[model samples]
Target chain A: GLAAPAIAQENPKISWRLTSSFPKSLDTIYGGAEDIAKHLEAATDGNFTIQPFAAGEIVPGLQAVDAVTANTVEMAHTCSYYFWGKDPTYAIGTAIPFGLNGRLQNSWFYQGNGNTLMNEFYATQGIYGLPAGNTGAQMGGWFRKEINTVDDLKGLKMRIAGMAGKIVEKLGVIPQQIAGGDIYPALEKGAIDAAEFVGPYDDQKLGFEKVAKYYYYPGWWEGGPVVHAFINLEKWNSLPKHYQAALTDACAFANTNMMARYDMKNPQALKQLVANGAELRPFSQEILEACYAAALSVYEEISASNATFKKIYDDQLAFKKDAYLWMQLSEYTFDTFMMIQQRAGKL
Target chain B: GLAAPAIAQENPKISWRLTSSFPKSLDTIYGGAEDIAKHLEAATDGNFTIQPFAAGEIVPGLQAVDAVTANTVEMAHTCSYYFWGKDPTYAIGTAIPFGLNGRLQNSWFYQGNGNTLMNEFYATQGIYGLPAGNTGAQMGGWFRKEINTVDDLKGLKMRIAGMAGKIVEKLGVIPQQIAGGDIYPALEKGAIDAAEFVGPYDDQKLGFEKVAKYYYYPGWWEGGPVVHAFINLEKWNSLPKHYQAALTDACAFANTNMMARYDMKNPQALKQLVANGAELRPFSQEILEACYAAALSVYEEISASNATFKKIYDDQLAFKKDAYLWMQLSEYTFDTFMMIQQRAGKL
Candidate 1:
């Protein structure tokens, strides 16, 4: 009884495969990929479905971007920094040591030159990236012993790899790359002295508290790490304009959702870890200052060699310098006031 | 040549109208409504379109929700607290004095029980609410003179209303209810000693810096205040499943986009405000403490009378208590360190 519109009548049915860099067990990060798939299906009435495969199902977690680039998969959900060894510019896509926090990173990407600059680098690599998720500010990993000074970080073999590894190495830290599943055992068996994963919710799942007593605050290295949705450039170009818009909106939704879930879940997970005798510790000023200096040096070294990294990093630093000024004035003051009330049991 | 699917073939063409409570000049907040319309139109290939009307175009700013309820429009982009006079529960849907920040509020809504609890209250008012925008933490306000202590607040005439008015009234301040367009003239003419607006980005547009030299921060009452996409419950229920999903995702995208734009824009605006002889000031600890105590007393009084307000507020406070604990440990420490570097000009 109705005449079908040209757009609807010509709508093409398509299905694609997505590989996630995380296992289904860590639902917060991996679930972001699933959310994109779910929203696309519901928005298009199951016309555009994406089947998700966990790490190792199609390729190893660290190899997700490689799969996307090779066209082995149409898309990948991963953290860009995992392939930093190939190019330091990859690290800026996710995070950098002493880089922008989650909110600031999102601001830089969407409002500043982040999307354009980062995508320029990605396009060269035959990929297109969209920020799909974030893990707020992570912790400084679980330590078998308290890290009191710069001396404590010396010779500490930690499970950290990436731009953070390079920065820490300057502070006498021996960085080790360990798989997600192997972190707990490595810490327990003394094969590794400490490990840093995502925040409390995911870290608790990894059983880090069972082996390490001192849980540190402020993972200065990772800060606000972004997880990205990477799509093959050729495949991305072939998508209809409507599908592109739908996926963009869906990824943005997932980006916000992942952070919300972490914020909601981290509190309880942290409380549980504390009850299990996980000693919470703040990295002392001596250590923080030293690492901050070291981080700057590492940035200088990379910027000298990599022009692409330098361009994006320079833009991020400029934005960050001003962002923190405004942040410290408003949200900082408000939060500090509320925190005092909470400590006083007045809230 | 193609067999049309049942869903695609039955997709009905729809056009809806949205009224915003913000003026066209305040693009950050008002633009959020425009983004939703833009995304919806592009995603649905013009099958679904939403026309947005600025404040006073279709109805008065404060009457947006009413217009939606009366079916004058299908939806509205407005703050819930504007209708707090109708029911105190409305305030919780947007923000409250000393409540959750934007990130925490989003966490509560999407991951915690916020959406269900808030919608329950909205449903009672014949409305359905979705978080459409956030203006991170806001500046406290612009003041003609510095407020260095609680005593300085006594007998002060300020343009504030609703819950904050009640709390500040307990501190011997006379709260004035002035319209947006009237605020500039009031501050300039010494008719009001102080006024508060969104933040630096939107506040600069109001030209408060020219008259009120002392700008204070941590707008405690509106910390992370939310702007909602409110729909008539009857109209909302009639939407097709796919349309509902599209709207929901579209709103989330706008929510993130609005905050990103504000975060990116506020820094430059703040610098300009400072360059214009705007003296930045902080509310002293003594003043914050007194206000905190007065705010609690106000909440208690309202809780004694308003069950709906108490139900939603109690849940929020519980979430806020845990949220700050984790937030202070992670982002707080990180931001504090960065602020120190910025102050030292090391950045």
Candidate 2:
């Protein structure tokens, strides 16, 4: 901000509105829109400014995409998976069970033709999906009791969102779909045995660690979940090239900034959670393996029946294979080895 | 490119020149500047354009920062660590031995105070450093013969660059500082026993694989080296606000795009290298541990005598420790588990 240029814009003034899936309380997610607006305004010297409305202030969060498509709003920031009701292909737009991580997802989206393919799908719905933010990776959730095996999942009333809800149901777990604002109380009052939210940063704010002493990680459900800035194609097309560039480029900025902020903030939050009597845990290998198998069948069934899902699933599966190989050799190997050394007190 | 904005800009024309640290032959490294120039020109509808000059045209790649500082060129694209001879603090600006990986490095630079700190340092030299591109995790290097033990390093000659050259030297290896163009022949003619020039993309172009069959990985030295676009502070301050915004935002765009491009391209390149007789190898744990120790001590020695290096080194070390903890818990754990299941033919 200190280095901002001083020249004023000669273009026409413009104002727009952005509806967000997240409430104002979760700054990290909701702030994505605010950041974009800041950059746009700064670049244009206040010639353009966007006002962001939290979920339900205009249209409900889940209906954000529809609102944009209907021209009810100029733009919206929300996870694409929230619209799986429209089509299961939406799930892969955000995150998929046992799918790509943050870096791999970005690699595919920005470089591996994912942006083109997904946007092709979104175009049919009258929307353009600009990847605006990511939540690096989410924690599995806070559980009141530890889950030791696959059998521990039976009849468990757990609050999960999007596609993860459907996948977990196959393991005899009763999926409880609860709104973000309502999830904490449900878990606190024992209405739900467990709950999954963004991560330690947001989960700590929601006070999940207070009631659920057992904190588990590697959110198989939402590995590197991304939020899309859904813009109406008509509205987007009407904007000036420079303005469009500003918005598009700012979305990418928000995307990188969101992950960076989370990466910096989460470690501190995790430490606090552990210090607050919350026990850190990883899902047992048996449980993870079972869920992995269950997830595959669930995906297979959906892809077999849904043409849209089938198309994306096919593309993603192929891409995921290459990503897995490359990341295993580069990213995973580096982190794994470093972790061993760090844990071994060498670093 | 398919989704380019349709509107054209109405801005006045302006032009600038950029000196790059990489030669035209190494597209991956040199392309960072080109990508930035392309985005800026596109955003401004050709009203603003930056002409990128290959190394040795205006000045050698290593002197790029000096060219920018001296206003010999309007801008330059180069890795900051290439100037380690000027000051050890330069290493943290790009990459350090056992420093951050791609995502974590970006997180530190953009999200943390790294941008402000590094820019503050650059300002002292009358320049502005823009975070433009990253190469992700680079390969360890190509060697004519396999290295299995610490004893193999004794009296061995390797063409390594940056701070890594010094760290390896501490382990009794005679470091051979050769130009990129000279590295291949140096190894081929036995002037150097081993050589490294980047990962598969450029290394393949340099014909390292054909001459040296052993390709080692994790790079250990340059985990996620980032390229900085350096602008003369006076020239930058004189640009129009929107033009400044275009350049700054485009740099971020190029940063994301470069890494994404490398991530997508490296997998295929590695595969092809292997098919063409490159025997992939991981540095043995013994060598890695030894280099890591040597790196830490080298850093300590530098930080002990250099105030600037001490400041950034302390900050980076503290940040890396927490990053290690957080990554181990989330990023590492997820990738490791998924890779296991993936390699086991599960999912």
Candidate 3:
């Protein structure tokens, strides 16, 4: 056995409450908080413990940032875009329509100036944000009827989240902001003509395929949306250095784990959904192009109005250009070749 | 301030040495070890320190695993495939020709049965492995002349790494195993017809563009190669649980950060390489297809003889099919659309 150091003896035992924006039922997303707690506890050997609470336990899911801001909890694990109603800048912390994919988002945050830029915005909100989870390039959503063209989106009532709602509204769609739990009920009752949650794994859990027969390919709005652990600024600044270090490492671990879990689980779930009679379809190029135009227009409008949104969004736009260029040249080419082999059943 | 818990006082003060299979100049790859040491030290309040030595300090780069096995160093950071000479199964720990990309590799390791399977193989060698770094989808080697077809490869001498040499050898090419530092001189003096290193950033540092005018896309042999920390199994088993957790978290953090760093750095480096007279080219479809056939043939021969290789390789092949299928459906479509927009200058 090794001897204890002076600093080790000074290590504090701290208990923090982490309220998640997701319900316990959505394990992959909600599990980020659980992973953080479990790993931190194990690393500290009970010296530091983080207690995780599900949505509606301490406060509603969407109100997670508020609870953290009010210091009702030390931190909250939730999607940053969920709080975009407070400021459009919040959406950039997670994703913007037609923005970065999963790999790019992490690259932007960790290597590019993303963490510095977003945290500068977050500091004003009395929160310090650490990306803890991501659902990679989400499915377009479940449509009660096939959406074959831009005309199909007209007057469509869709349960879309965050800034995407604003973009799609430009495409003649009526966007509704419904909580994850309420989305299925709204879709089933015909209150929403379409709905988009995460990808196959989480979407399957909600059983959306039963009510909406056409499941779309890509969710343009929330590509690689990040789930963050937002800690109160005051609480974060007050932490002992080691505790803060542990928290950061814990979040990083959970961030990587969540994406891997989704990638691993989504394939089997999608296969199951198709076998059970769900129709998988890609959104037409016309609809995608229209959505792309709408997303750009929306960004231009916001960029002109809000400097904070403009600063971060502009930086992200620059990074995204180079990122996709590199991705297409290498990752895209390799994956395409492999997919062809897979289709030929030669893999 | 929070109070120290009883368990906190039990935290031990320990120091270990880590040998790395990379030069200190290759910061992104070598940086993984530094990141782990820095994070672990900070988190443990300097109670635990891991001193890292660059390659040749403790042992030569290829001798990393040997150092760890013999307990010359508590741990060593290296590419698992570098030891493929000992056993072919080692290649899968880093990459196999036309195997999983970075995302799929992480997904397979973390969520699929990758860690359990790989570690089982490592146990036979008296080591424990943890993924600490990755260079995402490396660029094909820098060639003095463009490779246009299958005929271009015949009688060519290339400095390639690991099991890739075995695959390329079947293409009627002679493969030389040269160290990173030696490759630049080897390529410059026409000692090797072509030489492959990492992507743009690392390749640029070695001045490969100076000697080789043609830079190729998508290193088919190493789509996503992982760098792992190989710890002596005996040392790993004896660690206090908290220390183990800290080490795991540190490696996980480094693993994620390494890929992000490459993604962020490669684009600008690529631009510089092009501006400096390096002609960028894609490996012709004929070459790719031919090499793909040769790789499969080599795998069959090995699989027929090696049960361990066959078992792990078969499982990976199965997971690869479903992973790529899901990837093409969502990630591919989204990235492709974004790439098209990029080319049109609409991004």
lDDT of 1 by residue, B203-244 (tens): 898899999989998899988889999999999999887788
Could you give candidate 2's per-residue lDDT for residues B1-347 as a string of tens digits? 31122112325578899999888888877888998888787666577899999999989888998998899999999999988888888788899988888998888988777888888788877888888999888888878899999999999889888799999998998988898888878878888888877778778888788788898877888788889999999999988777788788889888888888887888788778889999988888899889999998998899899887888788777777777788877666678778887787665
User: What does the lDDT read for residue B220 in candidate 1?
Assistant: 91
For model 1, how does the per-residue alpha-carbon lDDT over A62-141 read when each residue is reduced to its tens digit? 89999999999999999999988889999999989888888888899998999899999999999999999999999988
Q: What DockQ values do the models have?
A: 0.72, 0.42, 0.63
Instruction: Please give me the DockQ of candidate 1 compared with the native complex.
Output: 0.72
Each candidate's interface RMSD, rounded to one decimal?
A: 1.6, 5.6, 2.5
Cα error, residue A202 of model 2, in Å, equals 0.4
> Model 3: residues >4 Å from true position, as ranges?
A1-9, B1-9
Model 1 alpha-carbon miss at residue A55, Å: 0.5
Instruction: Estimate, for each residue in A286-343, the C-alpha lDDT of model 2 and write its tens digit.
Output: 9888888888998988988988778877887777776676777655556666777778
Of 1 and 3, the candidate ranking higher by DockQ: 1
Clashing pairs counted in every model: 0, 0, 1
Which of the two candidates, 2 or 3, achieves a greater lDDT against the reference? 3
Give candidate 2 regions above 4 Å deviation. Answer: A1-10, B1-12, B345-347
In model 3, residue pairs whose N, Cα or C atoms come closer than 3 Å (at least 3 residues apart or on different chains), thus clashing, are A140-A218
User: How accurately is candidate 2 docked according to DockQ?
Assistant: 0.42
- What does candidate 3's lDDT look like per residue over B92-140, in tens digits? 9999999999988999998898899999999999999999988999888
| Whole-model Cα lDDT of every candidate shown, in order | 0.90, 0.84, 0.90
